[model samples]
Target: MSFIQSLKSSLKASLGSKQRQVSAVPQIAAKASENPDLEKLLVIPVSDDPKEEQQRSHAFNKGQFLARQERWEDLSKIVNDEDQNRRASGGGMPIAELLCQGARADVVALAEHLLIDGTPEEARPLSEAISALEQILGEHSNNHVIATIVAMAHLDIAWAWRGTDAVRDTPARNLEAFELHCTRACQVLDPFCGIELDSPLVTSARCALLVGTPNAQTRVADDYEDLIDLAPEQQRHIRALGHHMLPQWFGSYETLELEARRTAARTQDIWGAGAYTWTYFDAVLVDPYCARYIDIPFFLEGIRDILERSEDQHNANLFASFAAVSIPNAAHLCADDLESCSALEQIQTAAQWIMSDYLHELHPLIWGHAMEGFDNHARIASIDALFKQGREKANQVFVRIFGEQMRKGNALIFTPQGLYVQQA
Candidate 1:
């Protein structure tokens, strides 16, 4: 069988009794060419140096080969050993990525082994590997990439542990690990303020107070409650700022007006007023699939509002993670000389220009995320495929916007830290 076919078989075997059918890999591959947005979303960055690229390619392929052969022990050893070398070398790919790749591969091997051996003890090493990865990630409090990868690894390990005797016995340990991963993620990103700061003075004062306040425990509860009480309009505004405005700090009078109207209309719904509070997370490491919407003006605007509302009232630093997705060709929108085209094209052009400006302004933070490998092309493609179900049209528009941005090599401004526009 081909590599993709083997992968599908492995996934099916692992998810046995779960009702999900394997997605058609050929169909997914075909979609990229048929849709420009899809193509843009799938672009993975290649190393500039041919030698390094070849090595990475070879390593990944070799890892996959070991997985197919069901050499679980050997695969684990290879990845674990490589991880140690990677740390020592300080190579291009972050430690988190290396760990994740290794862990994911190891998990696949373990799953295959379990299918035959059915030994719970065999899974223990996988858990240990994941824990080791998390411990390393936790040590670096400021490294968002490591934190995110660790969090994801923890989640994966937790999922893998589920339904087993191990999980039933040590639920608290799993929960604690998961919580620690999230806590670390929050700490890594807290300085970036995943929400907009009305002004630098306000932001600075808030940060200072947070640092100085000796008894801030009582304030978290009140702040949480305040966030819960915000009107839908206020929440919507927060969401807008969280999603768009903060990512690029490009909100104009028109953008603000449109968001305000949308928020008002949505708030009129009895259930909509505070729904964003429950739905949005404080610190999310966005997947590639979710990253496509990062450049959409309306989407970013909504995210902004949500993030602002979620932050601690006294300090915007107590914020969520709005990490970017990595997909092929997923970048901020840019303008092109398509003025002679139809009216729709002209409108798209305008939107692209607006998005481009926003992304440019937030380049520092956004590029940082990309450099850390938080968002990329493959992840974006996966997200595009996943979200094409209920919100097909909206996601398609996002795909287009992202594709345009990628063509220009413009990094997305998808984090709150990207929103603070310094005055010249």
Candidate 2:
């Protein structure tokens, strides 16, 4: 029996209830020999379409090339384009966000290298890049877009210097460097803080600065609130709000719950109850202890609302994979504490209706990323291997859930257009 299946069997024995509870994790119903036609299924993962992939590639490559060549003016134009603020049709990510990342990818990577091991030799390139960026800022002091890029570069380097170790563990010299970089980052962006002057880049830099700011604990919600309001279509901002509101970051569990609801109301016009779902989504993924705090019915309702509102298959696959794989994995990790935990069991059970009602096509990249909670440093042998692993798992999930349909002379096919059935 699987972990959840074993838990269910135990529950039934203990409760003495006549009603059967479905397994949250799929319970394989029929043997493979019983369904020889399953091998012909076409349920592998795929992108939304090739054209959207090409467009995303073009945007990133062009922006990175502009940044590498130091054509700041040209890069500014792309970031300032109205389309940049709009969410991409392929996935919900903001186009301008990618442009900003491309603009500072070189500097940020160097800073990240210094953050990890702090080798003196690794610091030279980062220092040189900061100096060059600082000089350009002096020449174009009033250009808010240019100032935003430099601010983010400094902000990242600041984190690199401070590192994630506790205060006592951090060296005094590193603390001083962290402060110096943070100060410079704030100074450049301070004048552009007003609403009229804010752009997507400017708003992002402000949010990033909250880590080093003295007033962050009280201001985390406010800063993110401004961001979500500016682009209510962007669910990423709402997701981030829940993260910073966590007890370890700026707020307590109560604060996280409150902010999730507040964001739901605030963005109801755009996301409906989806804002609440996105807020709690990443937090619980990274730390399952937070799962204990989730309001089961409300959270599940938010999930339904999200799938109903968003047409993007990426999101449908994202939540489906998250529920079926990620959250159940969390439950397994905390199995000792979960046996009597009814809420956690119900949370795991949510995957069933989500897969049945919402999921149409598979996106292996999303499923693969969920296996590691989308960690930046999750080790993988190769992209092809990652997708292959994800594909196999996804097929297992679908076969278990839709097995009856498959055995009855129907082949489930997931194309970019949508889910289709072939008569077997």
Candidate 3:
């Protein structure tokens, strides 16, 4: 059988005995191409040039392979090496962080399936895999690296049990399982929280664990403060804090504004006002009501600050993805709240300058999420559609922004190093 057919069959079989066909996520909506400008320029597509994605995936790939092979010691060595000395890839991302994330791929996939399908897998497959890691941890009780991995696995299992809908959407039984795993994740990770055992993964895990705690609202800022300080360069943590600051998660609009500014002040040396920009980046998109709370001038300045500080293509692509896909998409998601809608429009207009000035290369996976409203979890049916969605989004944006140049037969070719004009 063909790979897609085999995949579909196996996935269907894994959904338990309900007999209703199910998938990891909902089906992708067919978007008809309507832009006459879409054909104006030649584009460097994500699937066609996967080297950028591969650069980020190598650590995750290596880590998962070792894990599936039961090469626990080898995995431990990679973690330890990174823990002792954090290493950055050519794109300036911390390799150890990706390794830590990839280590839990097995359990995370199960949890993700549960989150998207809204059905419980009967065999409790993640339990068996987690137990193996726990056994390995028992043999090396002092290995905080393995403990971090174990803690992360429990966290993934916890989220799977809870699922990704509103609290009201989940059944009581699922909530019970979620709490049980979350509490265990907290306990397992307790030892690594000590002063001497300081690590970014541990800090991040703690920030995530706040969701399970009763005091998430009160402690969210403090936990994130420690994390951003510990890893100043990782603006993702700052981005997360903004989402958490929303009233639905941990804080109100007032609190979000305060925290964004406070974070900007604290990380000024590293991110400048860029910290404030990152903090508000996802907030407006995730919670449109929070848009008015953002400082418009400061936010734009930070966008410039971020690109000015880094020549690496990865950072550039981040803003590019946001400008090309995220803000434009956010504008359509607005139903009411004219004030919030107006704020999103402002950002959307600003996105043009980003496509024109800063964006040099593209990252397909990043753009994929950007195209799909930045919901990292599944919503699209086909796994392959992720990159395809990004390419289409990028093409549409390029055509609109560079239509004049393209109409004159100048095609823009993007590379990891720079953008080139191909004379036609």
Candidate 4:
């Protein structure tokens, strides 16, 4: 069978059971040559104003929401409207190419979520979204934006199948679709490699090929040098992903941190540095060998240093939040020995340090939950008013009063069942 034939067969199979036979459908071979202005529709514009930026943000977010809602028809309208508007204006594509790119990623994400949940009914929406994207790609084969989106759509289909036991049981046929889609995605991105190095879509595709599933593993680490050379700012939010992924390729903690710091210095973005550091800590927290390899105190001290070095309050808060999540898990490793002792004292010590250092940072996050109000905005504003009122009181009194107010009946408490929210 041809590529499109195989894809059609796959889509048909998704419509029902794997054993269902699919009738031959005419191959969708519509090429981009037919659409001379296709490239014009795929241009991504930079945001120069708040309104433009918000619109762009909203477009992408709405696309994601549509995908999650399984509203395939709505998604199709978005792409079509953007194409029409782009042609009419000869500029300012309604759906930014980046948003379209994200739409494909969202398709893949929703597909995986459905597969994991093991609900065949959920697959229908994914199949619909996938078919729609495929149709779009059929017409715009050479449009790199749509091509990337289509490629990722294919990758997601393959990823979903890889996780399904029915597909994996057939070794020869198992990754057939998966391999094809991954190759297609790579080929699409390979032509204009440098342009997409910073894209989360591209980064995620590369990561999927590397560490995905056993059947989906491509082990091809391409364009990483180009990635490392790009400054943190240039890398978008995805620069931290390198630090997250390189360990699987035999990179060490020190080397990864050095690369992260170098990228941070090159970009002079402290927030990126904090984000990068958090990725490493996140990895270690899941299975904290870092604490064993180095001393637990040393591991925690490094996190503290990152938090302190963060120039922006947001960055500092972000790093502290990561520490708050990671440190408690890692505390058991903090004892004089990992195998010999429980490390309860060390855990207590670490928790105390985090509480002391990050209480102010945690206050804002917990404050909303504590406040009784109509909505988030009202609650958050009420917190500000309370904080202001407290500030007028003595500093010590203010800290005690607001801290107690926020913690009362709104704190997260561990119970026999699981983590429970204390009700106000």
Candidate with the greatest lDDT versus the true structure: 3
Please give, for residues 111-167, the per-residue lDDT of candidate 4 as tens digits: 655565446665666656666666666665655555555765676567565642222
Better of 2 and 4 by TM-score: 2
Off by over 4 Å in 3: 1-52, 88-93, 111-121, 165-168, 379-383, 404-424
Note the residue pairs that clash in candidate 3: none
Q: What is the TM-score of each candidate against the true structure?
A: 0.25, 0.80, 0.83, 0.48
User: lDDT of model 3 at residue 152?
Assistant: 76
Leading candidate by TM-score:
3
Stretches of candidate 1 off by over 4 Å are 1-59, 66-157, 161-424
The TM-score-based order of candidates, best leading, equals: 3, 2, 4, 1
Worst 10 residues of 1 by lDDT: 312-321
Worst 10 residues of 4 by lDDT: 370-379
**How many residue pairs clash (N, CA or C atoms closer than 3 angstroms) in each of the candidate models, in the order given?**
44, 0, 0, 0
Per-residue alpha-carbon lDDT of candidate 1 for residues 96-170, written as tens digits (9 for 90 to 100): 233334434654444434523355544454444444444554555554333333444443433343322211455
Question: Residue 237, candidate 4: how far off, in angstroms?
Answer: 5.2
Look at candidate 4 and tell me the lDDT of residue 414: 26
Per-residue lDDT value at 255 in model 1: 43
